[model samples]
Target: MKWGLLGGTFDPIHMGHLRCAEEIREIFELNRIVFIPASKSPHKLDAEITSFYHRAQMVRLAIEGNPSFSFSDVEHQRAGKSYSIETVEYFLNKYLKSIEIYFILGQDAFQAIQTWKEWQKLLLLCNFAVLTRPGYENMGLSGALPEEFSAQFTYDEKTSGYRGPTGHHIYFRKVTFLDISSSDIRSRVRHGKSITYLTPDPVRHYIQKNNLFQMD
Candidate 1:
């Protein structure tokens, strides 16, 4: 079975995250989309993030009606900062040997992967599906990646992506990315504005019931 792993802080699980995942899943023909919320992001070390429990709850609520979407709390159970490579390794071991793992992320995150922990190994460990915005899509990987790393991949005519040394592919495909963001939703709440359509109703109600995102 082919599965897609989408990891983020998911501070509130907004529409942009959902739409991007849906488009990627359709393009890649993924059997399932696993939402992995980070317990602590190394990239956002200095930023104030929501609690793992609450974030995970928001993710679960956001994907409640969809059978194809599921939640994985592997990062919360693991120690240390929530690194993508470690999370990929965990799923590689959990699933069947024949399973094809796809690590999904936005173009911005995929471009800055060199700064991530064990990024080189992560690229070789699983296939990457990078989401690009409609008007700002950059279809080439040669410039996004550093020279030493980009040299490891060659363009594939069949997939319109680069085939990595490990046989996995790095794809940059345009998806319907909405302007919504978790941070923006939080800001709207802090300003006493409505976030009804920004996120799922369940998550919006949960945030209200729990009195979350009211503080800075």
Candidate 2:
């Protein structure tokens, strides 16, 4: 049971988000990928995030017809600011019988793991699948591997290829870089700019119809 966890605020799910999930699933032979929209993201506290219902609905719309992709409201159900380590632990405890979780994150996010709460314990609970854009090859663990988990680090280029399961190994997958961002999309909508390609067409329509992101 290899499951991929793709967590984000998902202000509105976009093409890059979908592509990343599809490519990763194909490349890693993942059984399924769960899109977990944060109820309250700890990192983006200053940003004006959409409601949990809106974000979760957008994720549901984005992954609609894909059997291999699904949405989870675990983070939304939890109290306080969302933390990756706590979310991973929730899955571990709930699916203790046959669960193997792989948390997927972008290179930029992965670089900031040192500052996350209980980050060291997270590595032991689930493997990390770091998604890198164009020029980020030399992007793995550095400095030190905590105190007791030094030998757990392993590198393999084959895991980046578009076949076979990466299993429980931590890896970096190089992907086509798209500079599209949720923040930019929100701003565009606020300024009456077209965000057609930046997000899914339906999601764009939803935003416009609901008059979201518009501010004085």
Candidate 3:
């Protein structure tokens, strides 16, 4: 089975995230896409994020209508910060060799690959589908892949992406470019502003019901 794994803090899963996942699933013909909310992010330690239980619930509410979309608490179950390499390793072990895992991320995030922990090994573990963010011109890998690992991939004209030495592929996908963000939603909610169209109805309801993001 072809599976796509998209992990993030998902402080509150919004429409932008859901749109990208849906597009990636359709583009890659993925059997399913799992939205894994991080227990704690290594990079965002200084930032105050929503609780894992709330984030997980929001993710569940965001993708409730789609059968192909599902949520996982893999990171929450594990201790300490969630790393992509560990998540990939866990999936590899669980599925054996029967599953093809595609790691879905944004172009901006992909550009900072060099900063990630064991990024080189993480790249070779699964196919990467980097979605283009709004206001980012040029959707290809020419300026995307870091210089350190640039030698590892050779552009394949047919595939319109790069193929790694270890058989992993990096695809630059163009998805629905929504400018929405969780930070903005939080700010809006804190200021008593309506976030009606920013996220799914269920998620919005969940946040309001739980009084999330409101200032103390």
TM-score of each: 0.96, 0.88, 0.95
- Model 2: colliding residue pairs: none
| Candidate 3 accuracy as TM-score | 0.95
Q: Which structure among the candidates has the greatest lDDT? A: 3
Predicted structure 3: lDDT: 0.89
Per-candidate alpha-carbon RMSD to the true structure: 1.4, 3.5, 1.4
Model 1 stretches astray by more than 4 angstroms: 134-139
* Per-residue alpha-carbon lDDT of candidate 1 for residues 1-216, written as tens digits (9 for 90 to 100): 999999998998988899888888899999999999999899898998888999999999999999999999999999889999889998888774478998998888877888999888999998999888655459477657778878889999999888999999998888886888888899999989999889989999999999998964
Worst 10 contiguous positions by lDDT, candidate 2: 159-168
For model 3, state the Cα shift of residue 15 in Å.
Answer: 0.4
Decreasing TM-score order of the candidates: 1, 3, 2
lDDT values for all models: 0.89, 0.79, 0.89
**Residue pairs in collision within model 1:** none
Give, for candidate 1, the lowest lDDT window spanning 10 residues: 134-143
